[model samples]
Target: MNDQTKTQAQARNDWWKGGVIYQIYPRSFQDSDGDGIGDLNGITRRLDYIASLGVDAIWISPFFTSPMKDFGYDVSDYCDIDPMFGTLGDFDAMLAKAHRLGLKVMIDLVLSHTSDEHPWFQESRASRDNPKSEWYVWSDPKPDGTPPNNWLSIFGGPAWQWDARRQQYYLHNFLVAQPDLNFHCEEVQDALLDVARFWLDRGVDGFRLDTINFYVHDKELRSNPALPLEERNDRTAPQVNPYNHQNHLYSKSQPENIAFLERLRALTDEYEGRTMLGEVGESQRGLEILGEYTRGEHRVHMCYAFEFLENRRAIASWVVETFEKLGEVAPDGWACWAFSNHDVRRHATRWDLSDAANRAYVMLMMAMRGSACLYQGEELGLHEADVPYEALQDPYGKEFWPEFKGRDGCRTPMVWQAQDEFAGFTTSDSPWLPISPAQAEWAVDRLEEDPGSLLHHYRRAVALRHDHPALARGDQDGLTCDGELLTFTRTDGEEEIFCAFNLGDTAAHMTLPEGSWTPLAGVMSDLEAGVMDLPGWGYVIAKREGE
Candidate 1:
């Protein structure tokens, strides 16, 4: 290769620094064949539509071989594709197509654990004397034939499961079918690295590490203290499940996880430009853990927390304060921001927004400082679909019915057209998850025809991020958390952009900092109508003169 080719390769490798990643929930994105399940070919078919959104990359959720217990989170194989998705050739074809379209591809990596059906685990649990026997966390039961400790599973009940074959207990913080790896063992770490290398060698650009903090646990099996009722917040699990009552100390998020992260980082460093973004899953110290994990250049490149994806109201102050707190806690670390994902309620449903409020959040999400991840169907203002109990595939939902519905609402299939069987997503007999008729009407084809549609506004909002350096790589500053008005400035060297948002139903106003500013692309509906009056949940963008 020529020097120019090498330079171009290096640039492409550093492509994620200020990039936008569009996440594709594989099962719900598109079904190519009449199999009722979305596949690699389906993603390959939709590459043109994804590229049209002006995103720099696509982060696909888990598609590895799995039992689908946690829908693809429970991986049975690390080196091959699940028949539900497609073959290795299909994944290669999708990656090639994405690269041709100038989009990077990042696959989900479930490193903390694997499906109990995985060959490694199958071998590890068979006899206890096999070469892979120590790969998973295995322990002897207490003298009273009780669990090793009181560590509770996020799903429900004890985290430890008894295995009669090995005559010992194994740890699983999620579904009983998913066994946690003993990262405390060096051989296990080397094996996981081999799994990462398999994909890296296959030309994947990066990985979205699932449950990154759950790689290790307190080895001594110390009983976690109960959280005070007043101090408890049940965002992580079903409200009906007592899993939320205890502080998650001994179960997961152990300090030893950091050393293992360094090992993962070192492997990525070996492959020039490869990156990994960790999903930090702690209720109280989420950001603090994020900071520690990504503080140095040698660790994971970035980490995302559940803060922005929670089902809570976020005013301008809360938004600013969240980032400010992040800044204070993780000064050198990077964040990947997203309002919606497969695991949570869609932001539209959580905010209970009218269509207008939904449009405003599109602008606010893109304007925030950090890399943005746009979940599938979020651009069209898709809300949570009401999944009937009969069709619910989520075990969490089934376990905690009525009081808490699980993630089925957010996992519904994407709609591509207003008029078609399965909303033009598939010609399949039936989609794995049913599509909402209401959602089908808001499909991309219908929205594209209307110039003032939320779909068009989303394109404009995302376009703004690409047009201005301040929106993408700028430093956040001059933030004010006044009333419902959330205002801030983003500066990148000489370029400065002022941004403001009204995150409430009440009409709110804030005086602009005294300066000459040019309106680049105002996102507010009332702004263009000479109603400088900030309506409920509206945003404005202005470029300063000096900038």
Candidate 2:
């Protein structure tokens, strides 16, 4: 390749840095077949819609071979595609189409465990003398015939399930049908690494490692200590769930995970432009763990914790404090921030923000440092769909019932045409999850016709990030939080930009820093003379030349 070509290729290889990733949950994105379930072809059919948002990549939730116990997270086979989703051939076709549209594809990889029905787990549980006997976390029952320790499952109940075949208890962090892999075993780590290679070889650009911090547990099988009420946060588990009671030191986020992450990163490095985005689910020390895993050149490319996706409303102080803490904890590390995902309530509903406030957050997220992930339907300003008790499908929600209604609300089928049955998600009368009439109003077809819609706002916000080098790849500085007004500056070499926001329902004023600043396209505030006036939920992005 010519020098200019090599430089351009290197820039593309580093695309995950400050890149915008659109997340798609396969079951809810769209269904191509008449079976009411979305498949690989459905995603391929919607690539044009995804690319239209000016996103750099697409992060698809798990579609691997599975029994759908936890949707597709409980993998029965990592190498093959689920027949419900489509075949391996369908995945190749989707990958080819994604690349052709100039979009990188990152599939979710569940490495912490596998479904009990997976061949390896089946063999391991069959007998203590099998070749794969040590592939899963297993231990003898206590003398009283109870669990080996007091580790609790995130899905509720004890983390161990007694297997009559081996007369021992096997560890399961989530569902009883999902057995945690014994990462301490070299063979298991090697096997999981092979799974990563399989996808990379299949032309995938990267992976979003699911439950990345839960890969390794304390080898001693020690019980976790109780967390003080003051120390406990609802970021990882719901306030109603008992999983929040423990500190979770022994059950997950073990230090041994770092070496495995390094190994995974090394494997991905072999393939050009491949990135790893890990999900660290720790409530107390999540950012610290994210720092450790993504601290160096040899670790995962970026990691995201639940800081921004928590239940609390994000005021100006909260936003500034969160990133300030992140800066202190992971100064050398990188993050992929998102306000909503399939696992949590939609931000529009979770934050209960008005249309103006929601639009302000879109600009905030796009202009943040590191990278960003925009959940499916976020562009259309869709709220969390209300799923009745009978319609609920998430196992996590079912375990915690009324108090914690589960993630099904956020996982409902994406609306396409406002007037179409099932919102054009499927021709079938029944979808995996029902689409609410309220959600259908924000359908793509409806939003496309309205230039002032949130869909257009999202596109404009994302375009600003790509247009300005300071916003896309600069270092954040001069962060100052004044009550409900937050201001910061981003600088990259000679390019610098000042950003300010009013994350409240009251007017605010800010004195511009000394510079000849010009208002940018994404600004929503009024500037006069030397002072700037921001209405409720308003923001401004000004470029300061010759920094």
Candidate 3:
């Protein structure tokens, strides 16, 4: 490549550094061919709509071959597309369309585990002496016939499932059908690296690694320590679930995980500008692990922790304190911020924010000091669906029931047209999941025409990030939460932007830092640059040029 072309390509690759990623959960996004389930062609068809949002990339959830045990997360085949989602050619078409629209594609890679139906797992379970027998985490049961350790699955019960054929138990951090791969096995790591390479060769821009922290385990199979109730938070698991009862020291977050990540990083680094965004699945020490994992350039590009997604109300003090903690822990590390995703309940309802509060947060995320992620339905301000028990499809919900419903509430089909019976997610009357009646009111067609809708607010907020270098990839400074107003400054080179948000029940105001500032247009505010008044759950932004 010529020098200028190489530089241009490099710049495009760097879009991930501080760009926004819009997540598309295929099963719920859009369905073509009347399958009632979304596919590659569905996503390709919506490329224009996605590109119009001004996002840098799209992070697609798993669509690999699976038994539908844990949806597509339980990969039966990593190299091929799931027939339900479409063929390999369909994926290629989707990639080409996304690239043509100037949007990068980041596919989800579930490397920590595989469905028992996977060829390797099928062979491994046939007998203990198979070539792939050691590829999965297998251990002998205690003579009395119990699991190898006290490890608990996030899905519930024991982490180990006894395989009758081999008379041994295999570890599974998630569903019993999904067995955790033994990362201790060099062969397994090499194989996953190859899976990553397969996608890179197919022209993927990056990856959203599922459960990145769970790749390695304590080889000795040590029992986890019981966490005191006060110390145990329902961030990793639901409150009613037993998975949150223990401190997962040996089960995951082993010191050896860094090496495997470095190896994966080295592989991605080979293809210039490709990035890795890992989902760190720890409740305690989540930010710590995220910081350590993304500390250096040799590791993954960035990691998102469950701190914001942990089902807690995102109050002003907590948000400021969390960022402060992250700043102190991993000042050099990059974080990918999101209020909601496929796994958690939609933040619009989870946080119970008012319309103004929701808009304020959109500004907060866009102005934050890291990359950002917007879940598929978040832009329309869709709340989590109330899927009745009879219609509940998530295995996790089926296990926990009553108190803690599964993520199916958040994973329901996206609403496209309000007038359509099924909200235009599919032509079939029966979608994989139900289309929420409440969400239909906020459907794309309805919101698309309303300039004041949350959809338009999202577009405007995103455009603001694109227009201001300080907001997109700036250095965050002077973060302070006073009363109900949280204030900070983002500086990129000589461009400095002052931002303030009132995340409270009452109106609030803040005094600007010592500088002449000009308020940015488009945002509603009764403003002079030096002092600003903010309503309950409101925000203001002003910029000052460099000296």
Candidate 4:
């Protein structure tokens, strides 16, 4: 290869690019202390299992000190581990074990907000003249004692909460207890960067920045405009939430977020091989914001685009729209895609896919361009658990019951033992969330003993991406989502791979692209070179003759 070709190849092979990230919701992964909560030691014990999945890194959800208002997302202390999770020493052990197991540890960083109990918030709200008063977003009430503007919280009601001490209205995009940080304040940005440096100093690898697009808000605090009826979608928030009513023009997705991200990226760059994947938390403009946040160097390494994590069916056309739109908007930008995460319903239940269809998507994501994030229980084909009203935990769900059951169904404990009464997740009579009967049936122990289980299939699919350079960090082309089939090619200069998926239940067919291709084994069956017949949830990953 010439120098130019070698440089291009090197550019495509960044540590975070085209890698698979396993998202571990620490609370539900495994309970080690019989306390009914998964802690750092539990995760340390399971580092082998995570390594077994062949994922490059594990993006653990917040275990930072918090009041559990929004679980750990509402962080109280950025520098210390929550007592329920374990001490900072326990976190060090987990990190050491993960690194020893050949897995990178990327923690979820909730920089946009903090719990109301956080000292910073308390000091900021204690009085307006304090040094930390400007650390959080605070505004005066209107003449009539109404909120500053019409910005709605994702949890429900106005985004502004009246602070009695300061006699001001504070902004919170999600729950009122989770106050938004004032990123416009240079001191706040410096403090957040100092927090990043603290983690980096501790030998951590990277961060999954929560609400990357929400860091900066309109300086003038203008009211958001009303969203057109047709433009509102429930992908970001439930339909019951009037948060979807506004266009969110002044509330979020501001142009100023990029500079902050660049500063963040620069800090990460200081640590060799460290990566950052920000979450773009906008519904209508997710893709556009993703393109903006990740199109250039000195920005986030990747942004998790939410178009795939919808309640809608996982059809070919939808995939086409997302891929084509990303290609159009940010041809050079990178995306980290996931069908399921802590915030949304599991894809298996959200899309209502059959066992075979579920298998198809596992392979599809691994076969596509860019990085992929695999949720904890997705490989088990676990359906959304049935967490009744009385057992409900998610505040979002409790606010809008019946119509939207919230995310607890998806956040239930990871099923470890098929036959164990409690699925081996906890010894306590009552765990944080119930391990639903549906999830219990797909326990890891049972699948470990079964060769043909989706769990093994997930392992092989991950291996397939690792084995072939064309599948990982490759340039995708010939992409089409027609009828029931989604077809595309991934080529990394030296070789090319042809990938096809049938999202529908019934069998589907499409003429093979021009090539002498050989089907890869151990992924799916019933394959042919030409006139491919793909059964429902069936897929093919074939290599073109490389001579």
Question: Best by lDDT, which number?
Answer: 2
For candidate 1, which ten residues in a row score worst on lDDT?
A: 522-531
RMSD of each: 2.5, 1.3, 1.7, 2.2
Predicted candidate 4, C-alpha RMSD: 2.2
Better of 1 and 4 by lDDT: 4
| 426-483 per-residue lDDT for model 1 (tens digits) | 8876789888998976899998899998888888888899888788878988777778
Poorly placed runs, candidate 2 (over 4 Å): 1-7, 522-528
The C-alpha lDDT values of all candidates are 0.86, 0.91, 0.90, 0.88
Clashes of each: 0, 0, 0, 0
Those runs of model 1 whose alpha carbons end farther than 4 Å from true positions after fitting are: 1-13, 523-532
Per-residue alpha-carbon lDDT of model 3 for 262-353, expressed as tens digits?
99999998897799999998888999998999997888899999888877777779888899899988899999999999888889898898
- On the 0 to 100 scale, the lDDT of residue 271 in model 4 is 77
Task: Candidate 2: give the clashing pairs.
Answer: none
Cα deviation of 216 in candidate 1 (Å)?
0.6
State candidate 3's TM-score: 0.97
Better of 2 and 4 by TM-score: 2
Positional deviation of residue 211's Cα in model 3 after best superposition, in angstroms? 0.3
What lDDT score goes with residue 381 in model 1?
Answer: 86
